[model samples]
Target: MAVYEKVKRAIEQMVGDKSSEFKVCVEDTRGTLGGILIKIEDVKTQEISAFRINEGDEGEAEHMTMYSVDTMLQRRKAEGIARLEEIERVLGIKFEKWQREYILSRGLGYPIGGRRTGRTLAHQVKTLMKSKDDIIIYPNQRWTYLDEPERMRNSERYAQGYVKKLRELSEKLRNHGINVPRVIEVDDPQAEFLTKRMNLPARRGDGMR
Candidate 1:
């Protein structure tokens, strides 16, 4: 019989379709017992079963795992564009493309792409901002400035104001048991970089006391 057929039957017989969802794979080996290997999946628990397809050996082996699609999707959805924007709003950081992707990738969600989605997400973040971190005193990329130097100067001023406000806010948040970043250093001369790392939880609704 075919390798897939053998594995399919094994999965139906052992785990059953009602109890599990799985995919099958056939692999060829080079050094160790080189032959067609039939593999079966238990998607509900992210478990795997492997069996060799040789005339002499037909033994099955179970691999340890906790593989569940629900779990994986939950993790990924948390990293959605909406979530990153929420973090940006909460920490009062200007949203950067790399940072959004980083957060989305962390939770296994789709990355933000293009202006339509980006703008929609940005708007959504404004709604989600709970405190001062939601406000950007100086916007990045020069929304309106005469020259690069003028923009940089204005940005520097904005950074200084943002950091000073952030420090004051951080003190208040700390008092209420909200975790804030250490703010090791900023170089706006005026403090303009204003890049701070906030302690957002891995999942939503986690901020509620």
Candidate 2:
């Protein structure tokens, strides 16, 4: 059996009788790095067509390299040193390899000051509202939020940030003569929003205060 036929049949079996009104197309792509592209779609509704492609598989993944702990650590250290050297060379700023300092990482959600993407909040909102695609991918966007205890502080800060963003967006729209909500309401504006302790992620980063 051909590779494409095998993949198509496997998908059909996975979907069972539901795939009766659907089509799965697979094509072998040629080049230096060869692979197959698989596309699946519903023939009736054409609502969703999720497709995926595979690049070249160089070797048997089951026998992939598993380096020793010592070797892995050494390799990581070397890579870090090389990166620091490259940064210093580009910026002409010296960094002592041994000297390290911890800084509170505030860059969790949005880009700092929203200056990185160059795409303004207004533009983003307009684009989102105008988009009619069945599937829209959000890069650097998180779907689920993990709210934590009041002591953790990361959780409630996001809500506050969200309010701030809404206010900013409203102001931007108002500037463009687009009347949006004048007031954005929320529960407990000043208090520390609390959550159950069981949901805490098992992370040891900087020791949660």
Candidate 3:
């Protein structure tokens, strides 16, 4: 509760004068592991966004998130080309590049690798799927998500963001010739999402229904 208060106040400060119009909730996403999930909502418009601060992360990457995919693509393309050229010069092999844009909600997109790159990814995934004899579950990739979804999903609007990401990601995977959707739903009786108790009675007693 103390930690929640501290983080709530910090967010309130960041939100400024309109902070009163917004509601913020903080929960330990993974109990005893210290991963924090923050959800914010507008009272009038009911606009919402979610962010997570991982156990060891200082929230630096959230700030470092690139809004301009063009800039990021340019930088990454240059680095990739340099690496490719070096490999080609030394190994006597040629390479190809493919560029395509898949809209992420609107106005934001990630410039991913070429058709060959995607095909390679599909091959690797197929290899993994068939590896029942040598499968290692929970490989410890340490990939904790941040607020990138809120930024990229539904053009900065959030309610349908998760769904949009799921559907689009499925489409992208199919385009990569992968037969699996990168989304899943677990029906947990203990689970709730984007829900809150409005008032005391609404939370408990007569209004519980």
Candidate 4:
């Protein structure tokens, strides 16, 4: 069977009867400027058509679609980095690579901030380290090697440094073009005005600044 046909059939099966009202078209050879040329819509005469075309035996349609999707995701990630840069520029701060990776890998959603579950950043990080044997905090970012209760206070210093670094990093990220909350006064502010004044949204749709 033709490659386009195979892909089209596979897509149809995956979509199942959910596409009853829509038509899918498949072209034997389809090429789009940016990606695959696949359309899902309604067909006349109470029928649905699902059409897909192949640019060649290579299943260019599917390949193009995948490529487009990957490209979009890459663009988003770049935008995120850019935003981080803007944050730094605006906040006069810098972020280590390890810290950036940690935030991104967490998938903790945009507008990243320190962990806020009543547990301190140090505690959470320590817990993560204990649970995941493979985790290694990078050299640029300090980590606590807490094995004894007696060392708690000393280990906590590491946590304090991390918190300070993260705040600086977050600011740097905002300056990098990532839309982040407008940094107000960096010095101590009134406690009552702290949350209310800076509660504005930081992240944009594309993670852009």
- The C-alpha RMSD of each candidate to the native structure, in angstroms, is 14.4, 17.1, 18.7, 14.7
Q: How do all models score by TM-score?
A: 0.26, 0.22, 0.24, 0.33
63-136: candidate 1 lDDT, tens digit per residue: 21122223444544554555454455655676666545443332223355444444333332322232223333
Per-residue CA lDDT of model 4 for 83-183, tens digit only, reads 55654465465655655544333233223433452223323232322221222232322333222223344565664454455445335544555433321
lDDT of 4 at 176: 58
Whole-model Cα lDDT of every candidate shown, in order: 0.42, 0.35, 0.37, 0.39
At residue 137, candidate 2 shows an lDDT of 16
Worst 10 residues of 4 by lDDT: 200-209
Candidate 4 C-alpha error for residue 206, in Å: 15
Better of 3 and 4 by lDDT: 4
lDDT of 2 by residue, 1-209 (tens): 25445544544554455445456565556553355544455443353333334444312111111112223334534644554344335435553322211111112222233333422332223222222222111111111111222323445555455445544654565465542333233244222222124553222111112
Count of residue pairs whose backbone atoms collide, per candidate: 7, 0, 0, 37
* lDDT (10s digit) by residue, model 3, range 1-209: 55445544554555445346556676677876457776655453455555667654534323322212223334544644553354334435443332112110112223453443443222222222222222111111101111232333344234234334433544554565544334332234223221223331101111001
TM-score of model 4 (CA atoms):
0.33
Candidate order, TM-score descending = 4, 1, 3, 2
Clashing pairs in 1: 45-67, 46-67, 76-107, 76-108, 92-133, 188-191, 188-192
In candidate 2, stretches whose alpha carbon ends up further than 4 angstroms from where it belongs are: 32-34, 47-209
